[model samples]
Target: MAIIPRLSTPQTSPDTGPARNNRRGMMWLAADLCFNIWALSIAKSLGVDLPPIQIVLVRALVGLAVLIPFVVWRGGMVRLANPKLQILRTMLSTIAMTGNFFAVAKLPFALFTTVNFTRPLLMMALAALILGERIRAKQWIAGGIGLIGVVIAVDPGSLGATSASGIGALFASVIAGTSAVIILRRMRNEDALTQMIWQTAGLSLTSVLPAIYFWQAPGDHWPILLSIGVLSQTAQFCFMRAHYWAEAGVIAPLGYFSLILSVTVGYFVFDEVPSIGLYLGAVLIIGAALMASHKGKRG
Candidate 1:
């Protein structure tokens, strides 16, 4: 296990140190955004016919196959130590990944993305309660604003009007957010490669049963599945790099970019336009993300 550094305020250092790091961080952030768009595009192309678990299993297996070579090139099987913690992390990640994929498959892309934005707000509360990190008044305020945004986006009155699938997507966001906090905590003692390997492997193993039970042969779906696996792995790798160059607080907010990407893709590809409430909610969520990013910079 490696000790992950705590998030720190950006400080002046000699010779453009902070600036260079920020640039690198932003580059990785951009890469992550692109990767996410690709992943979503693949999901959209696949449509909802294939079982979510089956899709996840295929992606996980392919991701494992892709990553294994890299892991081996890095240092072979020895790169993975601390099997107990690895297993725990993998299980937590599996839940998050499974839930997220299911949501994507079953829900509208824009709505699904909006709900996913709740992760940062949840992270703030989790940090205070579980990590013993101080939560400032501003952050609490931001969290409230973000929650309001989520409500606006979901528009509870429309829950029944809309598909129950949307509600499931929202719930998946909660699970994913909590899982993220756990991953952050564990990251303090784990290498990024080790974390990725175990998480993907866990996803592969856990999804096996569902994939079998609901096994729909790949057919024309092979390409999309492979794309999802590759894109997801790349996005995660870029995210890890971003965090390494910067801090979680700094990089996390950039995740909001996914919403913009998703909305664009949804409109152009599926001819689905977001409602006013959705835009309003998106604004609030983006505001919260900005505030959080600023706080991270100043912390």
Candidate 2:
């Protein structure tokens, strides 16, 4: 799943003051940060020689296993209504998942993450075009800065670096951004639990064909494969809860902390460190996200 900004009113208690809201918001940000870090780690681990479809299937199956209990506890299978939208969401999610897995498997974690970070910028543009939301000048500037960061991260000078995997990741970013825009626009109309259920169920069913055709036995990698699904579901659960407690503007910028987590993990786990150019690019991207968050709050 993609991390999108959730613009919601902070939950407040009858006795508590603004201090409570601040505390809850901070907790939400922490949760969001932790979720992304775990997600990136799982993605990196699963990148080892497995086909994207196989990884995704394992992820879907695990998500379904977790989701089944929740759905049953809530109201059983009948709770899954809106079959058509669920199908569409699932198809889009599958495409995004395939692109993301392929990119992670092929590119450096830092580079892949830098490219993925472009989602916020893409979200701004798509919000205007698809949702008819007005685009502010600040939003445009942030988007431009983010684009510069992407260019720097994906340096054309690097030999054999700009492969189809990189291109696919870029496409995935766009798809993910668009999905977020839609979710943000429709947040009021749908509950978070409902959205989560649809995504999990839809992707699980839709991906069956690709998973079947490209099916590789889990082999000795069952632990890793299971981890991917379980961690992903946990992240989604945390993200959904976070949204209920805090505003998207506050939580969204924290999502960039994933870069730091990825870089650290890449270094220790893979002994791969980001170049100075990559660091500079990361700063630019992060700055843009901060600016956008500030603008979003003001508006």
Which has the greatest TM-score?
2
**TM accuracy, model 2:** 0.84
Per-residue lDDT over 1-299 for candidate 1, one digit per residue giving the tens place of the 0 to 100 score: 11123245456678766533767787888898888778877876776667777877877887778777766676864455567666666666656666666666666678888887777678778778767889888988888898899889878777663357646755865766486565557566766656666667777888798689988888877887888877877787777667667766656666778888888888888787889999999899878857764644543
Evaluated with lDDT, which candidate comes out highest? Answer: 1
What TM-score, computed on C-alpha atoms, does each candidate reach? 0.82, 0.84
| Model 1 lDDT at residue 171 | 80
| Model 2 lDDT, full chain set | 0.70
Clashing pairs in 2: 6-248
